[model samples]
Target: MTYWSGFCSLQKEVQPIELTKRQEMILQIVKDEGPITGEQIAEKLNLTRATLRPDLAILTMSGFLDARPRVGYFYAGKSGNQLLGEHVRKLSVKDYKSVPVVVKEETSVYDAICTMFLEDVGTLFVVKEGGILIGVVSRKDLLKSSMGNQDLQTIPVGVIMTRMPNIVRCTLEDSLSEAAAKLIRYQVDALPVVKEAENGGGLEVVGRITKTTITRAFVELGEEATV
Candidate 1:
């Protein structure tokens, strides 16, 4: 079956290509004398047309060179960073978000710590009955609460969690770049992904965006270039 793909598929099709020695020479030759045929380029390089075919194909496919019917190859004139930015901007938060680990506000700080360790997550979203977000608790928040003599089991997470209107969050529609910027600006490890609730209630937690998620996206981008 045929599956429809979005602009994100371009990430795989056009990567920040690393040109080889011969490929570099071919590109320079095209830049100097464009609208030149493959046969002509091969002649300039002192190689046969058959020998230069692979280099020519790589350049054309990577968007470094453009070819026309009988007109020959010309430079596409884009820098490496320009191409990288184009692919990265196409990624949306919805494509990379992970499932959220959440707890109710009434839960004790002790239980929250156990949940954080069990799930291997650094931040936990505190929600009401319908999964409506009310606050956010971090590893640091739990640690600070544990330091005091107050009974961890008795104190509710609501007492120490950073309540809403102050929590950093993103929505499914946000770009991955925007989410990354928030993480840096706030100096937080993760941002809860939220959306409007059906009954016009507060934002409801849907997913999460983290440093690891953005890192994985970039790593995939590099890997695709090699392939």
Candidate 2:
């Protein structure tokens, strides 16, 4: 819950940094005369280095310029779209993951379906004791099981779930771009975000990354860009 809150807060914080006129001038000067020192830039603008510090800082922080220790500042040469792509690629699965909807292996298919509907999630991570992930159950899995003659209340989800080694999953360190790619390549609606358990047990289910999750991210990015 705390993590999801933090993620929402982060999305709200991505306001567009509007460049000042002098900041625009600084960029043009760097573009025309790059590999140029900060002192040189100030000299060209007929301003003191101290007076231009904040503008330089803003440009650098906003990805409009890159600064070197001795070599000085240069144009980053990234368009707004490119910068947006770079930002999206840098998003970590851990940062954006939503709390996973989970079920135990022994959980009945009926109960699993109920949980899925109540939680409003398309996929459920099947975990053993200690939250160790064992398998994944999707909407299709439940639908298929429900169509069978077998009793839904009696059959355990473990019987129908796509078990580990067959499950396509992601780790905390994984980039969101990788998670999105896996979703496309596997044609799965969601991927469990997992991590190695401290007790050397197995991959522990931490959170979830879904098609909706990725879509939300893009939507948030669009909102930020337009802000």
What is the C-alpha lDDT profile of model 1 across 101-212, one tens digit per residue? 9999989999999999999999999999789999999999999999958899999999999998999999999999999999999999999999999998989899999999
Candidate number with greatest TM-score: 2
Misplaced by over 4 Å in model 2 are 1-76
How large is the C-alpha RMSD of every model relative to the true structure?
16.5, 16.6
Model 2: lDDT equals: 0.88
With a 3 Å backbone cut-off (N, CA, C), the pairs that clash in candidate 1 are: none
**lDDT, candidate 1, residue 53?**
96
User: Which TM-score value belongs to model 2?
Assistant: 0.70
lDDT (10s digit) by residue, model 2, range 42-135:
9999999999999998899899898655346777984555545556676789889999989999999999999999999999999999999999
Q: Estimate candidate 1's alpha-carbon lDDT, on a 0 to 1 scale.
A: 0.89
Query: Cα lDDT for residue 88, model 2?
Result: 69
